[model samples]
Target chain A: MSMTMTQKILADHAGLKEVSAGQLIEAKLDVVMANDITGPMALPIFKQMADHVFDKDKVVLVPDHFTPNKDMKSAENSKAIREFSREQCLTHYMEQGKCGVEHAILPEQGIVVAGECIIGADSHTCTYGALGAFSTGVGTTDIATGMATGELWFKVPSAIKFVLKGELQPYVSGKDVILHIIGRIGVDGALYKSMEFTGDGVASLTMDDRFTICNMAIEAGAKNGIFPVDEITREYMQKHSKKVYKEYQADEDAEYDEVIEIDLSKITPTVAFPHLPGNAHTMEEINESEKIYIDQVVIGSCTNGRLSDLRKAAQILKGKKVADTVRVMVIPATQKIFVECIREGLAEIFVEAGCAFNTPSCGPCMGGHMGVMAKGEKCVSTTNRNFVGRMGDTEALIYLASPEVAAASAIAGYIADPRKAGN
Target chain B: MKAKGTVLKYGDNVDTDVIIPARYLNSFDAKELASHAMVDIDPTFTQRLKPGDIMVAGKNFGCGSSREHAPLALKTAGVSCVIAQSFARIFYRNSLNIGFAILECPEAAKDIDEGDQVEVDFDAGVIKNLTKDKKYQAQPFPEFLQKMIQANGLVNYVNQKREGKL
Candidate 1:
């Protein structure tokens, strides 16, 4: 039987010839991950199951959420994960000075590669799907179980094929593409299903773009989002990974529950308004309406805080000054990206533009700390999820947009179109 | 398995962030987490919630994050079971892994109102609204899920399997 890419990977991991949608099977895991928030919760349960993890090398832990010690509780949370990693003798544990966001650093460190079955306690673990891996987020207990057994049960998910046809417009990136798609399909559009990106347009997106797209797959309620392995993927793996990797391709006759065609050229700079990632509006739509002003602009997160994202924001903010009314925070995803930003002079550009360039952290994306908005405040952010009170005050409003739009909005002190801002 | 409770109704996409906001994620204390359950969306949720209360909501409930804290918060806050038109996959899996009961029934979610009393029969997949005198059938759990629930949760099920008792 013809099988989709996800099905093929699942079957291979499960040591079966074939697996179909909704078929429950026990598959070996290539990696099991947990962050500070979830890691602490999983440790006690993990201890209950076994004295040691299934494999020290395979169980990865990162304390990114409240790292740099936000408060007494957050400090304690990070301390638990640190102590557990030492006790377990885990090879992949990432500490504060060396760690970035879990999703961003894992790939950069080459710990996750194509055709592997991976699970992380953080929802954005789906980000690894950009490498053509079958990855999904799970609860702390699942993480604990995977760490103990090196295997977990999964119901093979049916897939929705997104055939991308054209090249994206200028100033439009993967953030816009995902925002546009989520806008078209409500938040639950791909619930419990694999969102497989295919077609010629896939080659047009950069690795950073693909990462941005896949990172927010959870926002669309997808089991995972994947891009087919290509030259770009191979080159990325070659550069960062030393481990041998496998690649899987979908059968031409692979079954998909539904097929949605996306014209990439038609996708413009888009933004998801306050309250939901699915509440999207294109730059064109926002321009036609009343000006939506803001109090802050955050240009970073696991979603869009990669090197390219920093460059995109810097390109728009290069010589421009942020509006006096708006406070802009630029956070690079990882320490490597942070150093590169400084090397590339992007940090200077941000500082010159009056933006606060902070250390690598998840920061304000989940409202853990740094750049928290006040009540009645509004922020234009490049992060994923605009759910109520996500950033800070329950009354604060968050507008999710691309880094370009975020920079432009900061300059204009309102939600402004990136395409129009620089020019 | 059965549960009966008063209903606390909500609308579509009642996300995990709102169910238990990120700000309070530092502490793993059950009671502290429960104290802030649904604080973002409904500040008085803990005050309004009582033991054996049934929470009902529209489509795509628990729509964000993989935080088990969300379900743990609701369960500890005394929500007996959650009935929704649909649920986000991670949240669905998390709820079951923790042995927090949840049912999906569009009709029941749509017709159920706040202050109504409802009872659920997990084995029979029935949801009866005692206040409205109406009944709705929920989507039954799959065999594996039913087994997991029977074993109390994923951890227990794993333990049982290791002991060759599953």
Candidate 2:
């Protein structure tokens, strides 16, 4: 069988002679990560079972989700995680501004790389797949095992090809592309397969764009999403990582279990409905729905909180203040991004437009802290996942859209198209 | 570490929230987690699971959250081993770190059913599903890993290391 770059990496590292689609193969693991929040509980379990401290080098810890705790409970949770990190002698524990978010920090620190199998105590661990590794998120127990034993099991999954052929239109960021894909393939469409993203349109995107696209692959229930290292990848790696990376590309004759072609040009700026990424809609289509009153409009997360996303939201919100009734919050994915937004004056633009920006944490992504909407309140968000009560009350509603839509919605205090405000 | 147990079947995408929901993230007690294992998905996984029942899941088992309560819940609930087609990354590692036998039988999930008496040989990297009378391949534990497993978990392993037996 023709093998794609990802397949080859998984197969070769799995210690098997050769692997085909849907074949079960277990591979050796190279890296493992956990954050302060998850690591606290997980380390105790690890301590209960294993006699050794975690291999200091193989483990990484970041305090990203709740950088600025709003209350004492969260503060205690953060404190526990810090104490656990110190006790375990974990070498890498990122601070608020030093490094931010588990996913971006690991890669930025050269901890995540190609041909590695990494298990993090976070769900978005699949973000590393963009660099050619087989990576996925898991519960806290799993991170403990990887750190303790340095191994993980994997059933070779069938590949689903997402072939993109057209360029994205103006104001349409990579987040929109993923939202469009989610719309086409509901939330659980790729439940047990690797969603391999390829095609000409992929060449047009940068590394950050690819990361944003792949970061949300798990939302579609994909085992992982990947784009082979290209010039764009090389450029990003050269600037950030000093280590060498082995990149993979799908073979020309590689066979995919299923193929879905997408014309990026055909996709309009879209939104995911109240409880799933799979439910997608264009602004025009959404205009027909009952008016959506948003209590909050957020623009950040592993999904859509980047310099580009911030810039776009700033562009749309510049000079136009958000409605008094709407509360807008932005969480930069990492410290670098927060720095960039400030450096480029996008931070000012957003703040000037009534959008409050927070540090690089997953504050509102889990609905735990930061901007939790009230019962029956509605929110438009850019982060992944809009499950019932995901970011607020169970009775609260959520609409997932690109940063542009979120910004526009903040101004109008209801779901409105950014294009309509084309002042 | 080697363990023998009965097979307990589960379907796909058994997430962490199902194992131990977000609401129960507080507290680090093992028994506390075990009591809530699979409460969200089955609400009976804990009560129904026998002391030596080994859990086997189809694919994407433990797919959400980094909650450590999952494996702790499974271990405390009396699951002996977990053999799955695939695991969400974190759960796989967590299971091992906590000393629960996680046998990587990528195909065993598809082959075995509920209530199959299985023998998991960590040193040999194979699972004998006695009920099905089939022996499925599993990744053998390396020498270092065997020591870690025998010690029961990471903390135990560290203790053993401190004793200079590692």
Candidate 3:
């Protein structure tokens, strides 16, 4: 039977001849990860559930969310992971400087490979799907089950195919494409379904762009999002991957629940207004309709903190100062990305533009600390979710946009289009 | 198999961020997390809610983030069950893994009101709102899932498996 890429991967992992949506199957995992926030909780649950980890090497723990130890409690939480790693002899535990955001660090370190099943105690675990891997997020208890047994049950999810066509205009990117889709689909349109991106337009998206797109799949309630393995994927894997991996694709006659054709040329820079990623607006609408003021601009997170994103933000910030009324916070997704930004002089450009460059952390994005919003204040962010009170102060508003839009907004002290901002 | 409680109602898209908030995530203790459950959305929630209260909400309850804290907080705060029009996938799985009772009954969600006296029969998949005197049907759990829930979550289920008690 012809199968979608998701079905093919699940069937292979579950040791089945074929599988369909809604079938329950227990499958082995190639990798399972948990961050500090979830790791502390999962550890106790794992200890209660089993005597030892199912596979020490396959379990990875990264303390990125409250890294550098936000408080004594955070320090204690991180210490639980460190001690568990020692007790279990875990191999992939990452500490400060060595650790980055789990989603970014996993792919960069080659921990997630094509056609493998990966699970993390993080909603953004879908980010790995960009590399042609099948990945999804689970809760701490689910992570505990995966840790104890190296297996968990999955309900096969129907898939929605998005065939993107046409060339992207200047300032338009993968972020715009995803925002446009979310706008059309609403936050729950693809509930419990896989979102597969295909077509010639995908070939034009860089690895960074692909990562950004797949990372936000969860915003639209997708189980996972994937792109087929093409030359771009192969090249990225060759450079970063250590183990051999097989390429997988959906069969020609694979069944799909829905197919959406998107014209990239029709997309422009866009933003998701207060409280929901599905509340999208075009750059023209936001800039021309009214003056949307902002008190801050944040340019980092698993969603848009790659080196390419940094370079673009810096390009826009070049020779321009951040508006005196607005504060800008720049964070690289990982230590490696931070190094690259510094080496490429992007760090210097940001500093010269009066933007504060912070160390790699899930900082401000999760509202844990570093740059939380004050009541009634507004922020333009490159992070994925804008759910109410996502970054502190329920009354404060968050607008999600691409790096280009965020950078320009930082300079304008309000929501502004990149085209209108002087290069 | 059965639970009775007063209703603590909420609207659609009650995301994880507001359910427990990230500020309180540093602690994993269910009790600590519980103290703040629904505090942001309903400031008097912790004060008004007593043990064994049933939570009814509109569509997509627990929509953002995969943190189990959201469900754990609600469960610890004396929420006997959550009946919603729909749920985010991760939240649904997390609630089940933690042995929390959650049901999808659009009719019940629409028919029930805040402060309603309610009773649920887990095995029969029935929810009764005594205040409104309405009975609503829910999707029954499959046998396997029912067994897992009966064990009070995956941890206990795994423990039973390890002891050859399955």
Query: What does DockQ give for each predicted structure?
Result: 0.87, 0.23, 0.81
Per model, state how many residue pairs clash: 0, 27, 0
lDDT of each: 0.93, 0.75, 0.91
Using lDDT as the yardstick, the better of models 1 and 3 is 1
Q: How close is candidate 3 to the true structure, as a TM-score?
A: 0.98
| Candidate 3 residue lDDT tens string, B82-101 | 99999999999999999899
Give per-residue CA lDDT, model 2, range A169-261, as digits (tens).
777778788888878886556766788888898888766667777788887777788877778777777777766678777888788888999
Worst 10 residues of 3 chain B by lDDT: B140-149
Tens-digit lDDT string for candidate 1 (A196-315)? 999999999999999999998888899999989999999999999998899999999999999999999999999999899999998888999999999999998899999999998999
Model 3 per-residue lDDT tens digits across residues A1-423: 888898889999999989998888888899999999999999878888787899988999999998888999999999999999999999899888875888888889888889998899999999989999899999999999999999988988999999988888888777888899999998887889999999988888899888999999998999999999989999999899887787788998999999999998899999999898999999878767879889999999999988889998999999999999999999998989999998999999999999999988899998988789989999999999888788989898999999999999999888988877887
Off by over 4 Å in 2: A22-24, A48-55, A69-77, A80-89, B1-26, B30-166
- Choose the strongest candidate by TM-score: 1
Rank all candidate structures by their DockQ, best first, as comma-separated numbers.
1, 3, 2
Model 1's CAPRI class? high
Clashing pairs for predicted structure model 3, backbone only: none
DockQ of candidate 3 is: 0.81
Query: What lDDT score is found at residue B65 in candidate 2?
Result: 59
Candidate 3: Cα lDDT at A245: 81
Candidate 2 residue lDDT tens string, B1-166: 5678777788876666567655445455678767867765576777778887888887767665556677777888888778887765556656666677777667788988887788887777888888878888886665555666777765566557657887
